[model samples]
Target: MANLLSLFKTSGIFHLTPGMVIMWLISLTLIYLAISKQYEPLLLLPIGFGILVVNLPLADLMKPHEGLIWRFYHYGVQWEVIPPLIFLGIGALTDFGPLLARPGLIFLGAGAQAGVYVTFFAANAMGFSVNESATIGIIGGADGPTTIFLAAKLAPHMLGSCAVAAYSYMALVPIIQPPIMRLLTTREERVIRMKKLRKVGRLEKLLFPIISTIVIILLVPAAAPLMAMFMLGNLFREAKVVERLTNVAQNELLNIVTIFLGISVGATMNADNFLQAKIIFIFCLGLFAFCVSTAAGVLLAKLMNLFLKDKINPLLGAAGVSAVPMAARVVHKVGAQEDKKNYLLMYAMGPNVAGVIGTVIAAGIFSTILK
Candidate 1:
C-alpha cells in the first residue's frame, strides 16, 4: 500500500500546478491559431508543442542537461547560431532589385525604427531593466530573428517571450497593420502611385551586396555576423553560378535551422518563468511597438511626399516593418483596396527589404548601447 502511494506521489498528476495548466492552455491556443487560422504554422506549431511539452508535469523537457529540448535551446538558441543562419536564408531569397531602383525608400525603413526606440523608453518607464527593455523593444522591428538575437545577447531570460511576441505580431501583420495604415493615411494618399522603378543591371546587383557589406559593417561593426552572412547569401544568389549553394541556403539549411530555432525558443517558456504579470506587460509593450512602427513609416512617407514632386503611396510605408513579404502584401492589399488598378507589391518590396537591413542595424545599435 505504501509503495502504491509512493508511485502516486511520483506521478505527473500529483505534480501538476495551476501555472502548468495555464501554460498548457496557452499552448493549445497557439496550436489552434496555427492549425485553424493558418497563422505562421511553420513556427507556431512547433512552438506550441514545445510549450505544452515543457509545461507537462514532470516532463523535464526544459531540465538542464538531461532534457531533449534543453539541449536544442542551449546549443542552438543560447549560443545564437540559428538567428544569423535564418538571415542567411532570407538574404538568399531576397531580391534587391526594387530597393536598388528606389534608393530613397531606405528612409522609410529607417523611420519605421522609431517604434523600437519608443518601446525601449516605454519599457524602461514601466520598470523593466535596461537590458530587458532593449530586448523587448526589438519586437518593434517585426523581425523575429533580430529580436531573438538581441534578446539572447542582452536579456536571455526574456528571450522566449520576446521571440513569441515578435513572431506572433509578425503573423498578425495583415490584421494589425491595415487598420493603423488606414487610420493614418487618407484614401487619396493610399491611391497615389509613383513612377515605375528603374531597371537594375546585373553588375549593380552583384556589387550591391559587396558595397552594402563594406559600408554597413564599417558603420555598425556589431552587425557583422548577421550582415556578413546575409550579404554572402545575397552574393550567392546574384552570382548565378552557385545555384546549389543558393538552393541549400534558402531551402534545406533554412528548414533545418527553423525547426531547431522554433522548438528551442518555445522550450524557454517554462511555466515558472512565463506565466506571470511580466509576460502580459511584454505582450502589451510589443503590440504598442508594432503599431508605432507602422505609424512611423506611414507618417514619414506622408512627410516626404510634401517635399517630393512624385508622391508615393503612404500605404507602402507600412511595409517598412521587417515582417518581409507579409507586411509588403498588407501594404499592397490596402493600396489595391483604395484603387483596384494600383499594384504596390513590387514598390512595397523596396522598403520591405530595406526594413530588414534597417532592423539589423537597429538591433546592433541596441546591443552596442546596452552591452
Candidate 2:
C-alpha cells in the first residue's frame, strides 16, 4: 500500500488542487461568453476547453514536446501553418463585390491601419520588444487569424495575450466603434445617403481575388501564403462550380480548423507562460489600438469628403477596422439612430472588406520587419 501510494504521488496524477480548479472555472467563463453571449464561440469554445485541460494540475497533456497537445503545438502552430489555412476559410466566406464596386473605400481601409502602426510604437514605448510589440499591434486590425498567424511566427510566446485581445476587441466592435464614430462625425455626416452599389458581375468577382492575390504577392511577398490561400478559397466560392468545396470551407473545414486552432492556442497559456506583467500591457495596448483604428477611419473619411463631389459618409469609415459585417452593421445601426431612413450597410461593406485586406497587408509588413 505504501509503495502504491508513493507511486501515485510521484506521478502527480492525484495532486489536483483547489487553485487549479478555480482557474478551470475562470476559463469556463470564457466558454460561457463564447457559447451564451455568442462572442466568437468558434475560437473561445476550444480555447476554453484547452485551458481546462491544461490546468487540471495532473494532466500530462501539455508536457512540453512529449504530450499529444504538444505535438499539435509544435507541428501546426509553431511552424505557422494554421493561419493560412484559416485565411482560406475567411476568403471563402468574404464577399468582395462590395469592395470592388466602391474602390474609394479602400483608402479608408488603409487609413484604419494607421492605428495598427501607432499601437506598434505604443507597445514599444511600453517596453515590449519590437517583435512582441508588432504582434500586439495587430489586435487593432481586429483580424483574429491574422493576429494568430503573426504571433505564431514572430513571438509565439505572446500568442495568448495577442489572441485574446484580438477576439475580445472584435466582440466589442459594436461597443467601441460607435462612440468613436459618433464623436468623430456630425449628424449631417451620419445621415448622408450613398448611391446604390452597382451589381458586380461574376467575372469581376472572380477577377477581384485573382488580381488581389497577384498584386499583393508582388508588393508584399510575405503575404502570399495568407493572401494567396485567401484568394483561392474565395475563387472556390466564386467559381460557380465548386459548391461542395465552398460548403466545406464555410462549415466543416472552418469549424474543425477553429477547434484545433483554439485548443492549440489555449494549451500554450500555461500559467508560467501566460501570467505576466507584459500581458496586461499587451491587453491595454490592444484596446488603445482598437480605439485609435476606429477614430482614424472615421476622420479620414471626413477629410476625404472635403475634396470630393460625392461626399463619403464618415460613418462608413468605422467599418474599416475589419470586424467584417459586424462593424458594417454597427455603422448601419448608428446611422439609423440619427435618421431612420438613412441606410449604410451596402456602403459600409466597402470599407469592411478593405479592412480585411488592410489587415493582411499589415501582417505582411510585420512578417517582413520581423524577419
What is candidate 2's lDDT per residue for 1-371, written digit by digit as tens?
99999988877558776656665775888899999998888788888888788877767797877888878877778777777888888888988888888898899999998889999998888888999989999999999989998998899899976898898899888888888898888888889988788889999998988898989999999888889989999999999799899888877888877877899888777766776777788888999999999999999999999898888889988899988788999999999999899889988988998998899999999999789
Pairs with backbone N, CA or C atoms under 3 Å apart (clashes), candidate 2 = none
Q: State each model's CA lDDT, in order.
A: 0.92, 0.87
Model 1 Cα shift for residue 214 (angstroms): 1.3
lDDT of 1 by residue, 1-371 (tens): 99999999999999999998999998999999999999999889898888888888888987899999999888887787888899899999999999999999989998898899999999999999999998888899999999999988999888989999999999999999999999998878888977999999999999999999999999999898899999999999999999999999999999999999988888888888997889999999999999999999999999999998889888878999999999999998988887899899999999999999999999988888878
The best candidate by lDDT is 1
Each candidate structure's TM-score, on Cα atoms with residue i matched to residue i, is 0.98, 0.95
Query: Model 2, which residues run further than 4 Å from truth?
Result: 4-8, 11-22
Q: Tell me, what's the RMSD of every candidate? A: 1.0, 1.7
Off by over 4 Å in 1: none
